[model samples]
Target chain A: MANQPSIHAGVRALARLKKRRRSEAIFRAFGIAAIVFAMCALAWLLGSIIGTGYKAFYQHSLTLEVELTESILAPNGSRDPDTLRRANYRRIMQEAMFTRFPDIEGLSSADQRAAKRQNFDIMSTSGGPNYIRQMVFKDPAMVGQTITVRIPTSDIVDQYLKGNLNVDVPEVQRKISDRQIAWVKTLRQSGEIKAGFNKRLLFSTDSRDPELAGIASSFVGSLMTMFVTFLLAFPVGVGAAIWLDEFAPKNKAVDFIEININNLAAVPSIVFGLLGLAVLLNWAGMPRSAPIVGGIVLALRTFPTIIIATRSALRAVPPSIRDGALSVGASHVQAVFHHKLPMAAPGILTGSIIGMAQALGETAPLLMIGMVAFLTEIPSSLTEPATALPVQIYLWSDSAEQAWSERTSAAIIILLMVLVTMNGIAIWLRSRLEKRW
Target chain B: MTENTSKNIKFTCRDVRVSYSGKEAVKGIDIEIADRSVTAFIGPSGCGKSSFLRVFNRMNDTIPGCAVTGDIRMDGEDIYAPGLDPVLLRARVGMVFQKPNPFPKSIYDNVAYGPRIHGLAESKADLDEIVHNSLKRAGLWDEVKDRLKDSGTGLSGGQQQRLVIARAIAVSPEVILMDEPASALDPIATAKLEVLIEELKEKFCIVIVTHSMAQAARISQKTAFFHMGDLVEYDETDQIFTNPAELRTQDYIMGRTG
Candidate 1:
């Protein structure tokens, strides 16, 4: 400052320097602001998902006791768990509803709508039996008496709790007629029809209506597909990665293979679907719409990703480690599998999870392979036609039913939850591997 | 070649040349390595010591278009013999690199890796025993025994280098090739590695590539001087330093032109 120039040119130079500094600060501020914006978006998405999806995991219902009469249960009171399992729980649930609402004096009369609505199958699916069995086992005396049973409510009632039915809306738009709504108000006052966690969601098969649907078969379908993907993709991907990364000569053929793999990674997931439909379904005559076919398609979708990740993991292993192994008189293969692959395990597992998660959420590709159709019966094998959560969301969204929209949101919530759970597992496994390696 | 007095591994060079396509890297080289103990190859920058080291193991095979024309043998068996599997060759003649490389694995696994691959350890418990004993001989057991399950990469640099030495020892090779094994180390680590080398020479025939003439004089029993891709001198380490036969070797030892 003491040596500062008095000339006009020197003054102008100082002014320019200050302007540059101001611009840089502005640039930095914008950069930081952009980062903050991105973080805010991510937090909002996660919060909204957790908020809406939490409801799909639970249900609200009433506990009304209907006597387990001899005609209803064993047709003769044979009280065996296996026999109870075989004896249709659906029928038991239906009869309980009819028995409770015997006041529905006439079936066709609009006057007894309240009594008819009392009959909802809340305890009929596989998990529903667990509650029934518990009650039956806990006190055998309650079997023939008016023991309280938690029966499900109508979809209209569920919508009210789910915020789908706006309270301020006029009676015409709401499914629950104003009279029944007033009755529900009375029940709410009496401490009967309050919203609570639905426990029967996990074991129910997908319904024609999402409000009443369960995910039993779809859950089974996902497990089977993952089993198949794991069996087919993991070993094959790892084997190819090891060979390509460590053993293969840098010849033209290998170069071609590397290029093809990169190209394969870019191929759209729908293209994979077309290939699956043509090969597995049309020409091969394999089981149509089976989880096996869906899995094969998803495996194809996942294979390149696994291979690329494994190769990088293998490469990240320092060449010195390979030298150390070989210097110890280990063969090339020995140096790699015994030394390199195990070192690369954390990377490989992370890749595998990302691949599996992608496959689990994939819909368009599986859709072409016919895994998005009606699947009522529980699957015995991978051959059974089934829908995954993503496919279910897709199917529900396309329907004209207003209730199906809620189902779509519910499906989205479930799918997002599974994704979150998968990512959580990946983080857990990565931490475990990191601690050891 | 057969009538030569020394019963050592000799590299018979008749106009030996190494080239990358058209450009020659190693012009010509000729030398005989003694049968046992430690032999150090000392050279200046770009003198081709590392390139020469790779010629012995044929590690240059990984590089495309890298050509070598020379007859190098072990007990008269041509190392470059057709149908000689590099994979099998590597097992008999092991190598350690400049930087210590421990796999991202437990200390136990790092040492066990080699013995496992060569089928030296028959069972898991047997393998564990080998890794334990190897680490002990490398002067690292006391420091690392309590944390064998911790990743080898988690060790200090010197400890990691020692762990690598243990890994090299685990395979139980007859010859050990080290390419500047302590160059990337601190002084203490270097001293430890040098001490370990002296102990290792008793059982394994060792060859080391180094740039430090002082280190070469300190560790090796015999020293070979390499200059511009040629072996300038080979003699006892003390003799080579005190009285070199070649002018280049004399200049290098005296710090004149090197």
Candidate 2:
């Protein structure tokens, strides 16, 4: 031991300490890099979504005063509902458009009607006619009254107003022609067109016209499907966990079951979709594309998640609590229900919420169950045809039109908001139910 | 006290053997416990004293792979007979563990758990009276009277132990078993618990397992010495402590051997 010099020993110790410090620094650098990478990716996703989607919430419209004449609206000069229903309100809208632009009226005979029809097409095909029909039906006596109403502009004009169409691009490649673009500029200068809240996009359901589509039906469908998923998964998962962890005898069969349950949690979700197709749809003959079928598929996918969570929660409760209950003359069932289950309830609830959130965002399984079908009407029952929110976003993106892409991003923003709100509720519930041992 | 000493036998064991997964933990033995008295079982660590005590109320039945053979009877009925429910036996014979294990509930609820499970009370008022009497007997009513709604876990170690005792006695069991009930307490609390046990023996038969021979000598009227899973000596406490019958018992009592 004395052969080595004291100064050499100190130098060696310092060299080892320096090597350890260098490794520790490298580990810290790797951790920081991982965190920064994640944050940057998240920020990029949100920024792109918000930049493209903000315009879809607002729509551009043109205001016009239409003179409803008795000769065109009520030919018989009668107040009958059938006569009013058959009235030629389309001609009135055309006349109104002609009055707004007198240049079209002064054109020669062959050109005048054609020009009028071409200019009037800027308004939504259904919006102008539907407005006049509603007006005359509500009050038949006012056949000559002039009323002012704002109507949605054409989809291309709306996109142009939102700066989606580049005026700098060559005229051949641009969707809006030079004449239509000049007219839109003149209308804006005269204060005849303005941007307002898009109530149609918020209130209406699926539509063939991109300008009129909304997610109301899909939102309702998602709510219904999630409710069913929660109802089926929560109680069943908790019960299975209680039985396996507390009451079941330790044996070879139970050990096999426990291992299989863990493996089921890691299985690809689409496999469950195939299972649902064979078992629930084919064998039971359930209706295709219904929220009930979608919900059942998602419940099967979420069951393993909840079971694993509940088992760990039940295991976390100390064994002394069980002994305490049993020593006081409680039956096995009573001991579990009274002492162990109550203590594990908060953890179980948190797990169920997380499972439900996962089910909400799942798209691949939903697609297999035919939850991606087009639906226009809000579902009134579990058996009705429906599409979920994530499915709506998927369908809109697939079409890839001018305004549909914007609507897809808008739907994505809404989905993220809902997910954030659900997670917030789960956190609040956990805090409220947290107990000190 | 003298009159209570002559009470009839409350528990009878004959050739009782306990095995855990084919390995014997307690060998065959015979013993009788008198009613309304305190019997203490003292032994070295891992000597099967706690296992033998668990056999009285069939608490060992909850452990997987544990088997008990031979006759153990209470009130002239075999405890291990077919159709004999351990639940009923547990209700008749309550237990308190070495460590204080009060349920995560209010003080009133902790004392009320046993009676509630056994359906011993006719009304809420009846339950309240039973809880009140149990806590008073356990010597915790005066210290925790006003905070009946407080959690039992909030109490000190000694108070929590007493709360468990109160909970056990709430069902009005004829026998109460304690497994090193005071080993966790301080000297002052241990003295208080000894006094409470003395008082409790007037109404219920008490069996206690202890590692402290001084504690066994102080509180128990009869003592059993266990060594290496066998009963080395069984006699009156004074006789066993002063004049041990077996060489192993003498060596153990003298702190020379285990």
Query: Could you tally the backbone clashes for each prediction?
Result: 7, 0
Give a tens-digit lDDT track for model 1, residues A348-385.
Answer: 88888888888888888888988876666568788877
**lDDT tens readout by residue for model 2, A40-61:** 9999999999888878899888
Top DockQ prediction, candidate number: 2
List DockQ, one per candidate, in order.
0.45, 0.65
**What stretches of model 2 exceed 4 Å from their correct place?**
A1-24, A69-94, A106-118, A131-143, A189-191, B1-4, B250-258
Best by lDDT: 2
TM-scores for candidates 1 onward, in order: 0.81, 0.91
lDDT of 2: 0.88
lDDT of each: 0.74, 0.88
Error of 1 at B178 (Å): 2.4
**Model 1: lDDT of residue A115:** 43
C-alpha RMSD of candidate 2: 3.2
Model 1 DockQ reads 0.45
How far off is residue B9 in model 2, in Å? Answer: 2.3
For model 1 chain A, the run of ten residues with the poorest summed lDDT: A118-127
